[model samples]
Target: MDTTMGASRRRGRLAAVATVVTAAAFTTALTGCGSVDKTLDCVQTADTIADSVTDLQQAVEDAAHDPGRADAALDSIETQLRRIGDKTDSTDVNQAVDDLDRAVGRVRTALRNGDRTPDVGPVTDAAGELTKVCTT
Candidate 1:
């Protein structure tokens, strides 16, 4: 009887410890690096990318003589897109990154054409598309 009681006590203690540990882990998962924070980061990154695209367009318009301005804007957009990709953790975000990449490519091509009145139509369209993707 004593042996049986001791075994029961050990089992009870083990079960309690397991329950506590599980609860702690669950709480940590819920509170640390949860979806809410990730979503906020996504929103912020998307906004940054949109703003960068706008800045790039403006720079292209105003500083056509300074290719460095275009380079800086592209760099900013690339960094923001990379951050969004890194933090996305979802298929939607992945698609958004892909879309942004295509948009950036379009913009680069438009800028490189070197026509004084080059068809900015494609660059503008791409930027608009990227903005929509980011917002979504």
Candidate 2:
């Protein structure tokens, strides 16, 4: 009877230890998952910004050739910048996006009015700034 009691107590202790270790491992795994998710979000945001910049560059070229294309490009750029701002947690990125959006709106308005002499310098500067922010 004494031997049986000792064995039973030992089993209980082993089980308790196992449960503790398992819980710890599970918690650690969850923490790691959170980190991975954050990293993925950042990568996705960067890709979005990169794609927007590429498209905007092409649009600028197209606008130079065909003013009519500027409206669509401006709309696309505004939408993309908004999305990028929404997804990112960075304040600098959000501010940059907002600045670019405003500049794009100005360019769009000028283009719509058939202004052949629309100043593109602001838009160009904003885009350059955004590109630099994204690349870093």
Candidate 3:
């Protein structure tokens, strides 16, 4: 009777340990998944920004014929930036987004000042930085 009671206590201890390990592993996986999800969101938003940048380039070229196109492209890029900002808490990502936002603001300022072909090089450069940060 003593041997049986001791064995049952050992089994219970082992069961508790196993449950703890399983819970720890599950929690670790969930933490990893959060990071992966954040990365995916950043990358997708960066891609969308890239497309908007391309549109901005084209719009700048056609600005004399259709001034509204440039504004539309700028708006789209801002929207994507906002989406990314809302989703990420990473410092690098937030910095990149801020840089991009400033570049966009510069371009918008130039446009409002009546510069039809405002330099979009900064915008492109900032966007490239954003993409790089998102991937890393």
**Which numbered prediction scores highest in TM-score against the true structure?**
3
Mind sharing the TM-score for model 2? 0.53
Q: What's the TM-score of every candidate structure?
A: 0.60, 0.53, 0.76
Query: Which candidate should be chosen as best, given lDDT against the real structure?
Result: 3
Tens digits of per-residue lDDT for model 1, 16-116: 43344344444444664666566556655655655665566556656557766776877888888788787766786677677767766766766677632
**Two-way lDDT contest, 1 vs 2, winner:** 1
In model 3, how large is the Cα lDDT of residue 133? 76
Ranking by TM-score: 3, 1, 2
Scored by CA lDDT, what does every candidate get?
0.57, 0.56, 0.78
lDDT of 2 by residue, 1-136 (tens): 4745644554454344334434444444465676445434433443444445444445555566866555665666677676667777767666777887888778777766876445555655565455445433
Runs in model 1 deviating more than 4 A are: 1-33, 115-136
Whichever of 1 and 2 has more TM-score, that candidate is 1
Listed per candidate, the RMSD to the true structure in angstroms reads: 23.9, 24.6, 22.9
